[model samples]
Target chain A: AQSVTQPDIHITVSEGASLELRCNYSYGATPYLFWYVQSPGQGLQLLLKYFSGDTLVQGIKGFEAEFKRSQSSFNLRKPSVHWSDAAEYFCAVGKGNQGGKLIFGQGTELSVKP
Target chain B: DTAVSQTPKYLVTQMGNDKSIKCEQNLGHDTMYWYKQDSKKFLKIMFSYNNKELIINETVPNRFSPKSPDKAHLNLHINSLELGDSAVYFCASMGAGRGEQYFGPGTRLTVT
Candidate 1:
């Protein structure tokens, strides 16, 4: 069975501080990893994805993620956190060639303090 | 222009009532999906349709059925709605051979 785990349930960071959200996935074959962010009462917005290219991938809203196959982890990082960055972040593993089915993590809630 | 869109942004209904949530994608994607987000914000895939054909169906109850009249529209119909059905439902579309998915504004369904 495939699963995604986001270790941090809730994290608070000061504005302008560096942030990192941890994610780990379990899959049998080559993994397609993704990072998504959701604001309050809003649908998810894609942040970044790692299919089969570079280990580090950039995404919208000044977010980036690195896929570490050895560790089975895909963690999201931001150099400077903004108040607007306070939201829920999810890590997902895509089942390639399987109708695009995604197994999502439990999600980590980030809160920014000014 | 919205890439993917869902109707009835908010729905409040009594238990046992049947309701439908409609979804349409203008991106001309061949794959559409429905995801349920619980109050705790845990997201799960419920169903997926590829080119109007059922391709992925999770362990959802039989009361929930998905209908795709065309390649661009996928509608979810729930029968005998239970209080546990209260959650945010999201519609998403993905282009063929693309790993990225576009999501619509979710429909918050409140079953009383």
Candidate 2:
């Protein structure tokens, strides 16, 4: 079955440290990939997305994601994490012909340690 | 200026009661969508409207209905709300193409 998987349920990283959140999608062909972040008492914000072209994509909030077709993985990375970066991260997959429906993974919650 | 906005950010009501959540986008997007985030925080697409036309309807309860008054607005109505209906409902929109969707602050529905 087609699905999006987020392995880590919770991750803790010290402030100013590097961060990486893993996301994997199971599908036949490459689907439109996206990463969203949701903070407490806030809406889900689009972090970045990979449609085509270059595998490496930069997003807002100093975040970046790499789309690997062979691995079917689109992992989010940040070289230097900030305390304000603590939030719930989600990985979503969209198929254009599916009428804009998105399949999202069980989000991963990030905790920044002071 | 707000791109996408949802009214009644927090809703508390009893089961069997009916409620409606309104969403509007000032971005002039042609597509609008409704998504449900369950207790587990798993986001799932419930319904979508493209130019006032229903495009995607997932496996949702019949009690849940989505009405698109125009391209800029989409409202969700739930009849006979149940305890399981207690979840966050989010509204989102996209431009002409199916690219990144801008999301609105979710509505936290609490059914007692």
Q: Which stretches of candidate 1 lie over 4 Å from their true place?
A: none
Docking outcome class, model 2: high
- lDDT of candidate 2 over A1-114, digit per residue (tens): 789999999999999999999999997678999999999989999999999999999999999999998889999999999999999999999877777778999999999999
lDDT of 1 by residue, B3-100 (tens): 88999999999999999999999999999999999999999999999999999999999999999999999999999999999999999999999887
Best candidate according to lDDT: 2
Writing each residue's lDDT as its tens digit, candidate 2 over B1-112 gives 9999999899999999999999999998999999999988989899999999999899899999999999999999999999999999999998887678999999999999
Interface RMSD of each: 0.9, 0.9
Candidate 1 has which clashing residue pairs, if any?
A: none
The ten-residue window of minimal lDDT in model 2 chain A covers A93-102
**Residue B32 deviation, candidate 1, in Å?**
0.3
Kindly give the stretch of ten consecutive residues in candidate 1 chain A with the minimal lDDT sum.
A94-103
For residues A1-114, could you state the per-residue lDDT of candidate 1 as single tens digits? 899999999999999999999999999987788999999988899999999878999999999998888999999999999999999999999965988998999999999999
